[model samples]
Target: MKTKTVYCLSGLLLGLLTACQPSDSNLKNQNVALQLQQKALNSTLGYDLVESLTVEVGPRLPGTDKDIQAVNWAVNKLQSLGFDKVYREPVQVPVWHRGQAHAAVTSPYTQSLVITALGGSVATPEEGITADIVRFNSLADLKQAAPESVEGKIVFIDHKTERHQDGHGYGKTAPGRSQGAAAAAQKGAVAIVIRSIGTDSDRLAHTGMMRYQEGIKPIPAAAMSNPDADLINNMLKRSDKVTLQLFLSPESQGTATSYNVIAEVTGSSKPEEIVLIGAHLDSWDEGTGAIDDGAGVGIVTAAAKLIQDLPQKPARTIRVVLYAAEEIGLVGGKAYAKAHQHELHNHYIAAESDFGAGRIYQLDWNVNEAAVNALQQLTVEMADIGVMPGNNEASGGPDVSMLPALGVPVASLRQDGRDYFDWHHTPNDTLDKIDPAALAQNVAAYAQFAWLMAQSEIILRPVAEKQSQ
Candidate 1:
């Protein structure tokens, strides 16, 4: 009886050990598959995609004929790449045209100042408007100044942006460009001029979208080149009175139709669950839109293509979205959320790549507690490529930011954006700025994360509350 009991206990311990240990052969096969996919993505496929888009389609501003052409191009491209389904969803976008713009310091110094009209700004009269300049060091200073000090003046907000890898400086300084016009108008200023929200000290001005509050009157707004802003500051130090003449011919052309291009790789098992990857398609019309978003399109598209080519389909669908009118605002993103509100619960995970072709350095996520272990395992798999794990507070970029509000999980593969703002929305944002190696690195990181998301069975959100006994 004692010998029989010993044999039974030994058999039970052996069964438990076998169940706890992973099959080495299966693990080896998975590693080999991942290695093969990464190697292919780090090749020339990603670069070729960006090159074709930037060269063939060029800048695709929202609500323009080129925008339509871009939508068609993306559809054809995705179909050619063998996506299961490709389609376009219409989005109504505001059309704002930038005509001719000129600014000159007329009084203290007669010199032409490099400037570009901010998007959505009202047109200055054909003859132009000349006024004494009131310079403020920052937007907060402008807000605190007495109304009598700014009435009928050209308010200049001269806050400078700093360089940082994480791009926090752009967030800190962007408000001056986005809201300065409305704030100045509220204070009775005739117009507002701000230093370009860029890190470079170049002569080219960066132009982006600005907003006017509902009740606040719209006014002419522009961004001066960094060097020109410095010139204005120096002149203000010498003399309090610096008069300027500004002429801008921008006008709103009302609403126009744009599209969000979507393509998908169908899943073999759970077709209803989705892993979304996104990037914006519209640009500011200053350059070829190479680094701003053309790179992002290439990265995500190439990642999806790589996954689709695998011998076996993933467990969940991989959806790639090319959003529209992101430069103006997140119009396409907002429209997508509204259109797909009912199915948002099935979005297993979401991410976006809009911060240029810089190499990804860290991974951040906003998933459920139950999904944390899987994310940690993914980070370990990506360690060989120089990516580290980050905190859980992820914004998932501009296009998919609305998802988190609806309880959809999101992640961010944070890229090194130290020099992103230098050429952002400027004429300098051209194809020459992108490095092929960095672009390849971006594809590798994105492809790995996307694959993990599509393969895992982990539910990313809506953690069930513990049952009461």
Candidate 2:
């Protein structure tokens, strides 16, 4: 009887041990995953890598020699970083050059005014166009003016932006800068000059792309420096008979083929799902594209390098796309959308850092309720770093605008844009403008968020699709 009892007890003990064994193994695996993630998140070398790239390969305007050099630098750097696969996918980009740009008040009183031509603007004759200036407070005002008031005259659009992080003033005031030339041309104006659509009160003008209306001839477009704009504005108050001269020589050559350098640290498990981080590789020719996008490229590259060195990879692939010709337009981004349209659905989350290098203070995500809980938890993890949640109705940066339409979720680490427009698209966008400590903070925040998202089982639902449904 005693032997039989011993046998029954031994059988029960073995069964219990078997049941507990699998649970212990799962716990160990989970712990290992946590450690690996922590290791990646706490990387120091990764931060230095990004800093080095930004400092060494300053501006990379598409189609320019600098742009090509920047691409080569990215390729070599990624290879050196030991990415499993680093490749350059060819991207056809527009080639626009900013030649000599000069603007001055030739009449009413002679004065030298600072200015820069808008991207894709046609140049004036060698002697330049001298015309009577027609000033308007807004585009609507310009439209309201009589044809004779603007005909054969340089239309001056004077507007000012109130400083804000969301760049509300820019949105309102930028129309004159973008469409002013075409708008004035329709009314028979010889050329157009607008108050620089930037916040700085200094003598530095901002340059951006200008799109001409279909069938409308492109004309000379220029932005006066803020201080110059002020001088023009004060002079206007004193007299409406301000005459101006504009001289610009912007040429558009044949298209050039560049590449959006992309590399990935593939997932150990679910490789199909992608968490993407990117920035435009192209910059305006005025200065090194440091603040505009060099910082972004650096930020994304560093973030990914940190993840790559971890003992275990995240479940979803992390892709770094250094886009080309973002400064010209979304040319590179549009091309990317077209090339990857078939796989757009696979992009789980996409974030872009295009705004100037400012301390990131808020984070907004445009995902559905399914991932809201996860993001909320993530926000709690990032609160110590001054990152807070924003509205779910986010569409990402201008470069990745098409992705949201294709069901890719988008988010933003809303950097303080208070001082961004000051140096944005200007010659002041140099490496000295970047604050290292602030950049590192940005890196830490991005690293933590990206790792958490990649590790989490939840996926961010596409905002457009979610809204439609």
Candidate 3:
């Protein structure tokens, strides 16, 4: 039901009036926003979308056949949903194969270990490296080790990741996975294995991207389960000599084409000004990618779908971007920022839902000083979902984090991430892990936020702002 009365463009007459907006239309928008929030809270549309994605497309590792299928799926879904605009922008992404990984203790205590290769790592020799083990409790200890001692050995960094509501714990121990290979190679190690950067004690190895330094010896890197890491730690204490046979066959097969799928609900009046929300379309090879990002795609799309079906068109456009290759290194996010450099100022505000399907507990934003009060009503509307106003230092999530620096204001609806890392990059990240009710709660928050942001007389930038990307 499209509203017949289109409101005036606030961006067009901002100079003439501070917070220029029709009071009657503002109140009407609030009434619609509250209705949208209620609809979202009671709907399982988000869960249905994610279920379709995981079941139909499965895992969407960037550049894989499934990744291409996912792009096609997104286009069809957006078109089927009857959005005003649907399109895609090409993005070049590197292709890597997980192949196979095997790790086992050959000496002292012979036992197989659960492990997965870190993304972008090289394959080991066919025979694999069978060497003595050298354990380090942390990355710092590895860096300080004597070269002679680490030479001709397998380095194991047994650092453990903690659990927290905000998922800051993953950030804390992520360095060991990202830099462990480089540090181990510098100490003259043949290979490296780190404790999985997850809070779970289960025997599931968490896989993620890793980096190698220039001119440093590149070595095979992998992560062992927390229990396996603990097993190795105990093995080291009991015996003077412990050996592991490692074999990983992951390899890069050049680059491939991917796309950032874009869909929009065009505003009736202020169409030039945009209210953007996004989630990564790509996921790890391990699981169906349900929790890592399938849930995110569903959440944002469901939110936008609700807005699109609204009786009255919002004042600002609502754009939903399902980004490509975000799992590797935020490729789509960086590409979007660079491609839209000329119009960054035109973006009214943005948000992203890359965290797992969880209840949104807080609303956070990073707007200019004068624009802060414009969000008060939006924050109050979020109260029904148990969300409170958070600090202004929000990064808008992994993918959306790229826009703010390019001068686009941003917001983050912080989810309950306490159990996120447990299934983050493991085989356990599947549809069953997501609760429909919790997913609905996320949709409720996102729909209310996006609808209100588009309808309200929000100021993304103060009159004093002049710098452009």
Taking the tens digit of each residue's C-alpha lDDT, what string does model 1 give over 1-469?
A: 0111000011123213111233443354346336644675558777888898888989888999888888988999999999998999999999988998899999888889999999889999899989999988888998899999999999999999989999999988889899999999999999999999999989999999999989988889999999999999888888899999999999899999999999999988988989999999888888889988998999899888887887777788999999999999999999999999999899998999999988899998877654555466544656667789886778888999878878788898999999999999999988888998888888888877887777664456652122100
Q: Could you tell me the TM-score of candidate 3?
A: 0.93
* Rank by TM-score (best first): 3, 1, 2
Residue 311 shift from truth in candidate 3, angstroms: 1.4
C-alpha lDDT values of all predictions: 0.84, 0.76, 0.87
Worst 10 residues of 2 by lDDT: 1-10
* Cα lDDT tens digits for candidate 3, 230-337: 999889889978999999999999999999999999998999888999999999999999998999999999999999998778888999999999989999998888
User: Which regions in candidate 3 have their CA more than 4 angstroms from the true location?
Assistant: 1-22, 462-469
Q: Rank the candidates by lDDT, best first.
A: 3, 1, 2
Q: By lDDT, is 2 or 3 better?
A: 3
Alpha carbon lDDT at 369, candidate 2: 47
